[model samples]
Target: MADASPKHDVFQAIADPTRRQLLKLLVDKEMAVTVISGHFPMSRTAVSKHLRILSDAGLVRERKVGRETRYSLQPEPLLELKRWLSYYERFWENKLNVLKHLVEIDSETGTDRTGPNRLKDDQTPD
Candidate 1:
């Protein structure tokens, strides 16, 4: 039987900026490597390497079309990433809520609850 697990980690595959852009390019349509490479400053071989990593991570789907290969986004794998990030949503919400409360207090009392060192909107760090 074939292994169900991906050869590469989704996080690792997307860690590189180039690979992330590759995913974005393929999001709307399938593309040949030559076409995809045109969007980057790198050589076609470098872009192909990035695509291979994405393919290993199951973030992209590849197929043969006549004499060329085509690639497209396979977003099902990203649900794992989404579910992992969702767990931290509550932490951010709590922090934002505390900041909101502090801002409200600052407005009422005419004081800076954010911190003593925070620069005002009109001020810049020097």
Candidate 2:
């Protein structure tokens, strides 16, 4: 089962595409806003919004160096996403295995029933 946790600021942070890209950028190495913004076609302000989300999620951190604020990746929160995805991995694997077995059986029998096994007219809906 998934962790039935309360609302986490981090979870929503990664849900956005822009924020995900920002996180990916930081994953490589620490960089200033100027450097990070260079990778995107959008304005620096837009990139800044993405960085803000990452910061709130604890996925990135900014440090003050002179007049610059350098951003670095924070990996601890990402482990949560990994764990959540891992839970579904087993469930999907089981479901896919069942499907594969059914497909293999159909192939061996020279029968192909890709949709409902029984015709809709053959049975009444429950």
Candidate 3:
């Protein structure tokens, strides 16, 4: 049986710098493949390939206007990535808060929690 999975996920789609720039270009306006290709150094075919990946990821929507094919950004799929990253953001925040508290304690006690300057509780200077 054929694989039912999408050809590209949002992570894979945006993994390439070119594809990320393409999405940025389409954020405010849709453009035909020709116009989109003009913004990059690559050929139109290359741009189309990037668009295809974005389309597979549901990160872009394409429309046919007569002979031209125009593409636009579809940001809904990116919510998954945002949600995933937000969890790590909170994790880092907690770590940073702990470090901040350690720094504050070290300053008040005239001790260093890091490097060779760290001192034990009984080693305070006179």
lDDT of 2 by residue, 14-103 (tens): 888878888887888899999999999999999888888788778888998899889999989888888889988997797677667666
Best by TM-score: 1
Worst 10 residues of 1 by lDDT: 117-126
Clashing pairs in 2: none
Task: Kindly report which residue stretches of model 2 are placed more than 4 angstroms away from their true locations once superposed.
Answer: 1-8, 106-111, 114-126
Model 2 TM: 0.71
The models' CA-based lDDT, in order, is 0.88, 0.80, 0.88
lDDT per residue (tens digit) for residues 3-122 in model 3: 867689989999999999999999999899999999999989989999999999999999999999999999999999999899889867976776676778878988756777665544
Per-residue lDDT tens digits for candidate 1, residues 1-126, read: 999888999999999999998998898999999899999999999999999999999999999999999999999989999999999999889767766766676688898646776656544333
18 in model 1: Cα distance from truth in Å?
Answer: 0.7
For residue 3, give model 3's deviation from the true position in Å.
7.6
Better of 1 and 3 by TM-score: 1
Per-structure clash totals for the candidates: 0, 0, 0
Error of 3 at 82 (Å): 1.1
Candidate 3 Cα outliers beyond 4 Å, as residue runs: 1-5, 98-126
lDDT of 2 at 29: 88
